[model samples]
Target: MKKTLFDKVWDAHVVNSIENGPQILYIDKHLIHEVTSPQAFQELEERNIPVLRPNQIIATADHNTPTQDQHLPVKDLLSRNQLQKLSENCEKNGITLYELGHKYNGIVHVIAPELGFTQPGITIVCGDSHTSTHGAFGSIAFGIGTSQVAQVFASQCLLLTKPKSLRVTVNGTLKKGVLPKDVILYIISKIGTNAGTGYFCEYAGTVFENMSMEGRMTVCNMSIEMGARGGMIAPDETTFEYIKGKEFAPKGTEFDKKVAYWKTLPSDEDATFDKEYFFDADQIEPMITYGTNPGMGIKISETIPTLDDASFEKSLNYMGFKAGESLLAKPINYVFIGSCTNSRIEDFRIAADFIKGKQKAENVTAWLVPGSKQVEAQIVDEGLQTIFEAAGFELRQPGCSACLAMNDDKIPQNEYCVSTSNRNFEGRQGQGARTILASPLIAAATAIEGKIPDITKYYLN
Candidate 1:
């Protein structure tokens, strides 16, 4: 019987299986951040249970962290206390921590893969949903709740029923200006949010094969948006190359041995999936969300669809949009180009390349945020910071800025923001804030245009 990438990795980590019941799955990495971890730590402390695998746990402070003023004291008392508790918990548990202002500090999803903590054929878990981002390396990664966090802390294992396999294949050359973000938005728009429910999705075909590591990460990061348990891409040369020479990656012969194992982790040629879908890449375009959920997206050149449903009307009403109305030239006030989904160095490079000689519109307040401190350093090292500053884009420090309204950076009520983050749920960016999810290129273009433009001319060639 042929096996899939998910099956291979998941089977390897199974510690015990009950007859027709949940299996005990070993977790290779447990990532934690300030907000969700404090409760889990407190639960363990109250019960006098020690963290079983401190070595496997990595802690960071990101959610609710202020994007400005790294040196000064944190202003939000709650945020400051959470950060302090995270530090104390990690120290008590003997787990390694990358605190705020630390070089390795960043969004939990961002720092893991960049620092070589994420690798192929491993099971990773975090309290945050975007933890699925690590599945770009062919891992069985997903999010867990606070109780599940305590379970992992107690045993470094989870009792879970296996998810069915689903594969999405897209072949053919991607059109110009259609990015990885666009490809995912296009998929969600076609399949809707519930298509991947009760499934672990595997991305396949030449389109994913040809993507760089950064692009693959971007694609996998949004897997949760479609309601998939997680998402995966088979590890290949690109995956190995990205993991090599990182801070925590094995060196020399050790790395070669690891690669030898990784090469065998891809799905077998004759493997069968529970469900499969194929798409033509040429049909995809630079996409943007028009409604509350990610599935309500359209090509930049298209108008809103007329759907008859109370929920549909509710979404349109929240967005202040009408059926059959084109978003072209619709004025926008805020634009954000950062998140775990698209805040990699390549994303900034794309935005910098586009905005190099151009100035942002006077009416738009554009914020450019890196995903991690390392990415922040790369921005300065490569002089992308100068280009962004000269183009009138504010280059904010790294955090989950404007992606969610947990921190100071927010989109005002009823104002429109063209964002590169994953979700566009109503008020996701702030109270009553309307979000239009797009690729970094679209976000940058929106900042320059001060509105949603029919960027067909720029997108076509």
Candidate 2:
């Protein structure tokens, strides 16, 4: 049959069809975090149910852990309690936990790939929207609610209505300064955030095929924001090579067989999609979110949108940005480049290269946080940490950190921050703090200039 990658994976996972509605799909992996697992564990206790597959379930503390000091107790009482509850729950359930300060501890999405826990041709679920990041390896992964999390734990399966397939192709070579982040943002702006509703998008194009694994993950991570059920890229040599020596990846002959299977996971040449879209990589520029929503973005060289041309005035007013005002020269109080979206080693390497021999702007508060302890180790071994430290950037522990305000790292009220985090919806970083999301390269340039600049000048060089 002419089927897309989503169709093939969905068909393989479905145990049975439930009348004309959702089907029962087997889950191969379940990842839990501090914020969402506590409620699910409580539900299990109330119902007197034991986790069906504790070995397959992995837990981590990221959302509420302090980034500055991993050894000390968390100061925020509520945050501390949340972490405690999760630890107690995991202990009682006998689930494997990678607590703060552990080598494996990191953002759930980040640790999964680094450890090779995320593999191709399997169904993976997490209580995080960014679980879509796993799809970069050609797997079917998605986020579930608390109740659904409980359901997966009980049965290792989920009831889901299979999403239709959509193919989005970017055919040209990307221009200098145009990163995978910019490419996805440009697609969202062109297609509207809701355009991919009820579909699983397959990003298949020359640009995507040539992109590094980290870049592929960045685009897939934001698939949910575009209203897609999820997004996936075919597992290729690059994907396999990245997972080869990781702790959880198949070893020896097992790996060769796994690769053989992964190779066939790509859609056949005659495969069909429910919908299709195309993009020109060369047309994309360095992107930044100006308004409240992620889709409310523009090129770094562009001016802030006016109310007449803007989609939402209330959001712009709340963000303290005026129409027709240029965002390039605006002053910034903080610059951050650590998040599941952009905290990978490649991201830090790019940022380090830009600021290796220079100093950060005196007025800017710059932070460089790796996505995982493994990445932190890589940076130290590669001497990237020395480069960043010499430039006056503070290196912090791996966790969700300031990506969400649950952690201690936060932007003060009314301050503007150039962050590499996913969400820019007002106050995502902290209460009443304004956020502008950009790539790590653009973030480095902004830190050097103390405001958004034409990053192409530095990035291209």
Candidate 3:
């Protein structure tokens, strides 16, 4: 029988079939973080249950930790307490925790992929919504609620109804300055945000085939934003190469065998899908959000859409944008480019390449945060930090900084920001702050121009 990648991984993890409903899927890797795990841990304590697989469960403190000096006390008492409680909970449960200041510590999504804990043909989960980021490695990863986290901890499995498969194929080559983030935003605009509801998205075709593993991660990381339960790209040579020599990947003969198995994880030629969507990659350019939702985006050279055909007018109006107005040359108060979405070393490399010999706009306040300690270390090793520093970009610690404004890196009130993180919901960057999510390349280019502008000139050469 022909099967899609989703089916291959889903069936492999299914331990039992329930009565015409959610199947009992075995979890191979569990990632926990401060914001979501504390409640789950408390629930487990209240029920008097011990974590069944402490070794498989990894914890990190990124959402609540200050990205500045780790030794300095957090200013917000609630955040400080959350971090402390996470440390205590992990210790009591005997779970391996990469705490603040640890080399491996970072955004849960970023740390897992860098450490090679996320792999093909496996089931992974986290308490946070961006757990979909792990699906980029060909794993069946998804986010779960606090109760689901407790269940996974106690049994390493959960009952889930298999999602139907939706194949999204993008053809043609990406244009200069266009990135994975732009491709994704363009797709969402084509098929609204809810197009993939209740489906597991299989991203295939020329665009994904030619994309680097990091690019693939960016695409899959935003799957949930389009209403997909998860998204995946089949394991290819690029995937195996990215996993090789990582901290947790298979080594030696085991690696060869694993690679062989991973090669078969893609959908068969005759496989059938519940739905399929096609896109032209070259049609996309650098995208920037003008409204509260990610789907409310336009090319950097275009004007914001009018309320005539747009459905989210109220939300868009609340975000301080009107229909058909050019976002170019608009005064931007803040610019950020560090999040799980675009904080990898390659991501920074792209940004640094654009601003290497230039300076950030004097009127703009920008923050450049690495996604993980490993990414931060790589930037330092490659001397990209020096270029960024010389160009007036502040290099901050690795965390989900400015993405959710949970940490110290936040946009000031009523200020407009060009950010590379996912989510532009009202106040997502900070209280009353407007967020315009774009690619890291776009974010960097805009930082130089101090507003939305065509970045082709910087990268065309």
Tell me how many clashing residue pairs each candidate has.
0, 0, 2
Q: Report every candidate's CA lDDT.
A: 0.94, 0.88, 0.88
**Stretches of model 2 off by over 4 angstroms after superposition:** 306-311
Q: What is the lDDT of candidate 3?
A: 0.88
Residue-level error in angstroms, candidate 1, position 355 = 0.5
Query: CA lDDT of 219 in candidate 2?
Result: 93
Q: What is the Å distance of residue 424 in model 1 from its true position?
A: 0.8
Find the 10 residues in a row with the least total lDDT in model 1.
452-461
Candidate 2: worst 10 consecutive residues by lDDT? 304-313
lDDT of 1: 0.94
> Mind giving the per-residue lDDT tens digits that candidate 1 earns over 1-461?
89999999999999999998999999999999998998999999999999999999899888899999977899999999999999999999999999889999999999999999999999999999998899999998999999999999999999999999999999999988889999999998999899999999999999999999999999899889889999999999999999999988999999999999999999999999998889999999899999999999999999999988999999999999999999989999899999899999999999988888998999999999899999999999999999999999999888998999799999999999999999999889999999999999999999988998777878685
List residue ranges in candidate 3 displaced over 4 A. 309-311, 459-461
Q: What digit string (tens of lDDT, one per residue) describes model 3 on residues 1-461?
A: 99899999999988999787788999999999888888888888998999999999888988867888877777889888998899899999999899888999988888898999889999999988778888888899899999999999899999888998999999998887788999998888778789889999989999999998889989999998899998999889999999999999999999999999999898899999999999887788888888888878888878876566545677766777777788888888789998888989889999999899999999889899898889999999999999999999889998898999987677888899999898998989889989999998888887888877656665542
**lDDT for 394 (candidate 3):** 87
Candidate 3 is scored at a TM of 0.97
Name the top TM-score candidate. Answer: 1
